[model samples]
Target: MKALVYEGARSVSVKNVPDARIERPTDVLVSVTTTNICGSDLHMYEGRAGMESGRILGHENMGEVVAIGEGVDKVRVGDMVCLPFNISCGFCRNCEAGKTAYCLTTNSDPLTAGAAYGFAGMGSHSGGQAELLNVPYGDHNCLVLPEEAQERQSDYVMLSDIFPTGWHATELAGLQPGESIVIYGAGPVGLMAALSAQLKSAAQVMVVDRHPDRLALAEEIGAIPIDDTLGSPIDQVNQLTNGAGADRGCECVGYQAHDPQGDEHPNLTLNNLVHSVRFTGGIGVVGIFLPQDPHSPDRLYREGEGEVAFDFGLHWFKGQTMGTGQCNVKAYNRLLCGLIEQGRAAPSWIVSHELPLEQAPQGYRHFDDREPGWTKVLLHPEESG
Candidate 1:
């Protein structure tokens, strides 16, 4: 099997790896058709996530089930399915409570509660950035796609991560129909947040970012683009919201946020959201914040153990509420998939490149560098079957 293997910081290469096969009775084997290089993958690609060398690197995956274990009763061979990045057991207490992202039975580390494919500190499960992938708890993890899935892989593949994650931000922020919302960052997840706001009937949707291409995508979806490079994003949001601030704000930039001069400021977006959102309003944080970043040049991040200089005082004084965590993708993928099948959602609009599996390293390089027009990249592994 061919896979995009993580070699080191800012490095990846297509290498021949051992074939992926059913390892348990509840597992299924998928012939990966489409997989994405997600923003999360950059954490590992840049050596900030402590990802091991030779590990396959992909989580946003969808494909044809080539084989199914005897214990797998629901998912069958030949079924087209999208696997959520979270590898859950479905019977854990957290899973029962609709918190599949924190499933207690997946990760071997007693200190950790969740597990994900091809992610550092998540689990040993290999990712689907290859010709074959082994899916455990097949019936539980595999989201069977609609009849048109073969023709719409680009959109359906998003159900694996960003789309649901973006939707999760809104849910956490308690967005109500007709309420205005502002989302920070115009990356894939942030753009999806803007799109999700529109689909949920937000009266006003504002997206903040310095990238013209990304902000343009948000504006194309009817979101007001706030270019932080030209002026204060908070002031821009205030102007759009008649000085009351937005009803809600979402932090989608995570710890990698920086100023226009390209200096890392982990607290930039969080503090901005505290002020950009109205008094007594809500804030949702869907950006990936690690427990620690030893590679970070910021002394606070490197020494204070990932603690950002957040505006908690302002947050409390404003009487704002907040929610933060990974998205429970299973809770939303089904409904979002229905919307896709009905022609109501098209997440593929953000896809900027599609390449063969061998070219995954190039895709990763361009996307990680934030190259213009390289918003998203999808990879197709050549079928061996």
Candidate 2:
């Protein structure tokens, strides 16, 4: 099988690798159809996340189940399924509590409490960015799709990650149906957050970014595009809300938070969210924040404890409640899937490129650079036309 492997900083290659096979009684073998390049993947691609060479680099995946282990009773061969990025046991204490993102049984290291495919520090599971992928706990991990799965691969594939992640941000922020919300970052996840806000019938949805292209996408969805380059985002939200600020806020920029000049500020988005959300409002942050980043400009982030200096005083004075973490995808995927099946949602609108597996390198380059019109890229492992 050919798989995407990390070569080094800002480099990757497609090379022949060992075939994927069922390795456990509860495992399933999948012929991967669609895979995604995620913003979080950039952390590894840029060499800031300590990704080892020879690691397959995808986590958002969906495909046809080619084979199922004897112990897998619910999933069957030929079923189209989307695998959650988190590799949870479904029987762990955390899983039982609806916290599958922090499942206790998946990651090998005892210190790590969560796991995901092809992610650094998440565990040993290989990702689904190849012709074949081995999925463990198949009965629990696979979310079987409807009959329209094949024709709607682009839309359904998002069930594997970003769609649910975006919805998770809304849930974390405690967004109410009639409330207004502002989301920082117009990247894929943030865009999905905007979509989720709309689907939930928010009175107003505002997206912040310096990228004209991304902000334009936000406009296409009827969201107010707040170009941070034009003025202070806090001021923009305040004006939009008639001086009260938005009802809630979401932080999707994570630790790579930066300004239009490309200067990295690990806490820029967080501080902005704190000030932009109305007093006593809630904030949900689904962006990836590391305890430390070797590539970060802040000395605290470079030291393995990714703590950034921010205004805890204002956060407390404002009495804002906050939620932050990797999204618990399973918690919202089913509900969102129903919306897709009913033709009420179309997350695929964010997909900007569809390339054959062989062209992954080019896709990564353009996406990494945030090239115009390359907002999101999906790779077809079988190289279908």
Candidate 3:
């Protein structure tokens, strides 16, 4: 089988790799139809997150189940499914508590509670960016789809990550209907955050970023665009909310966040959220933040940490509360899938490129550069059956 293998920083190549097959009795083997190149993938592509060479690099995945282990009774072969990036063992305390992202039974490292495919610091699980993928805990990890899934692979696949992740941000922010919210970052997750806000009836949804294409997508969905290139987002949110600041703020840009000029600042969005959200309001951060990586080129991320000198004093004075971490995707994926099944949501609007597996490296390059109209890239592995 051929897979897009990581070569090094900013370089990937399509290489022949062994087929991914069922490795456990509880596992299912999927013929990947549509897989996503995520913003998180950029962390590795840019060498910000050190990942091993030859690691298959996709987590947001959906496809038809080609084979299932004898122990996997509920999920049958030929069923379409979307696999959440978080690999949970379902019986763990965290999974029992509905925090599947931090499932205790998956990550081999005792220090880390969560594991993800194709991610750094998560675990050793290979990703699904190939002709075949091994899905563990099939009954617990796969979200089986309806017949409509075949025609809507792009939309259904998002339930595996960004859609639920965006919703998780709002949930963490405690966004209420008719309340104003501001989301930092206009990328796929940010755009989905705006969409989630609208679905939940936010009084005002403001998206902050300098990318015209992204901001335009936000506006198309009824969100007020705050172009950071024009002026301060803090001021814009203030003006939009009559100087009270937005009722809530969401951070979706994580450690790679930067200002409009392309200057990287790990704390840029965090401080912006603290200052822009209304006093005593809630904030949700779903962006990826890793521990110190001694080899990291960025000073802030050196020594395995992405440290920032943030204004906690201001945050405390404002009486604001915060929630931060990876989105425990399982907590919300199924519900979000229903929304897609019913046509209440259509996140595929953010998908700007759909390419074959061979073009994945090109997809990675353009997306890493943030080229125009390359908002989200969905890759299709050639069918094996």
Candidate 4:
């Protein structure tokens, strides 16, 4: 099978790789149909996040089940499914508590509590950016796609990661009806946060980003767009909120945040979010952050990593609350999927390009550069069925 293999800092290529098959009694083999090239994948692509060479590099995946182990009973061959980025055993204590991201059973990284696919410090699960994937705990990890799966792959695929991730971000921030919210970063996740905020009936939705194209999309969705490139998003939010700041703020940029000059600075977005919300407001951080980077200051193309100089004093003085981590995608996907099925939310609006699997390398380049009008890119490894 041909898979997108990580080749080092800022490098990837399509290469022949071993075929995927069910490896455990609980496993399911999926013929991947649509997979996404997410910003999280860029962390590995830019070497800010580490992965072994030859690792397949996609996590947001949706496909049709090709085979299932004898133990698998909930899902079967020919069923359309979306695999959550966080692989978990539904029977784990943590999973029972709805903390699927930190599932005690599936994520144990030999030394830690939880793991995720295609991520550094996570488990060694191969990604779905290829023709096939072996899904462990398949009965729990795969969400059955609605009957409209064929017509809505673009939107349904998002249920695997960013859509739920963005929704989870807002949920973490405790967004309420009629409240105002501001989200940093106009990336796919950030845009989904904006859309989620709208779905929650936020009185005002504001999105901050330097990219004109993303800001425009925010505008199209009735979100007030703030160009952080022009001035402090803090100031813009202050004016929008009459100096009290927004009711809540979201940090969607994660560790790859940047400054006005495009210098990699993870803390910049956090700092902006700190000052953009109200005194007692809360902030939700869905962007990826790591404790250490092996390639920084040495790698030629390190993206979005640096000492995060945050305003601890302000955050402390304001009595603000903060929630940060990878979104436990399963936590919110079921509800979001129902919304999509009812046409109440169309997260697919953010998808800017869809290409065949062979075009993945080019898609990566365009998305990594945040090329004008390129908000989200979806890759299909196989045509319908």
TM-score for each model: 0.99, 0.99, 0.97, 0.95
Q: Candidate 1 on 63-116: residue-level lDDT in tens?
A: 999999989999989999999999999999999998999989889998899999
Candidate 4, which ten residues in sequence have the lowest lDDT sum?
Answer: 297-306
Across 1-385, the per-residue lDDT of candidate 3 in tens digits comes to 8777887889888788888888889999999999999999999988778798878889999999999998998999999999999999999899999898998978889988999988887899888888888988999999999899999998999999999999999999999999999999999999999999999999999999888899999999999999998998999889998999999999999887877777777788999999999899999999887776554446756753567778999999999999988788888888888899899999999889999998898899999898988899999997422
Collision count for each candidate, in order? 0, 3, 8, 2
| RMSD versus native structure for model 2 | 1.0
Q: Candidate 2: deviation at residue 89, Å?
A: 0.5
Q: How good is model 4 by TM-score?
A: 0.95
Report lDDT (Cα) of residue 275, candidate 4. Answer: 84
Q: Model 4, 294: alpha-carbon shift in Å?
A: 3.2
All candidates' lDDT scores? Answer: 0.93, 0.92, 0.90, 0.86
lDDT of 2 by residue, 1-385 (tens): 9888888988998889999999899999999999999999999999988888889999999999999898999999999999999999999999999999999999999888889989988998898888899998999999999999999999999999999999999999999999999999999999999999999999999999989999999999999999998889999999999999889999999998889788998889999999999899999999998875777888877885888888899999999999999888999899999999999999999888999888988899999998999999999998833
Candidate 4 lDDT over 268-319, as tens digits, reads 7788888888899999999887766755542322433434668989999998
Q: What is the lDDT of residue 320 in candidate 3?
A: 95
Q: List the residue pairs that clash in candidate 2.
A: 291-305, 291-306, 292-306
- Model 3 TM-score on a 0 to 1 scale: 0.97
With a 3 Å backbone cut-off (N, CA, C), the pairs that clash in candidate 1 are none
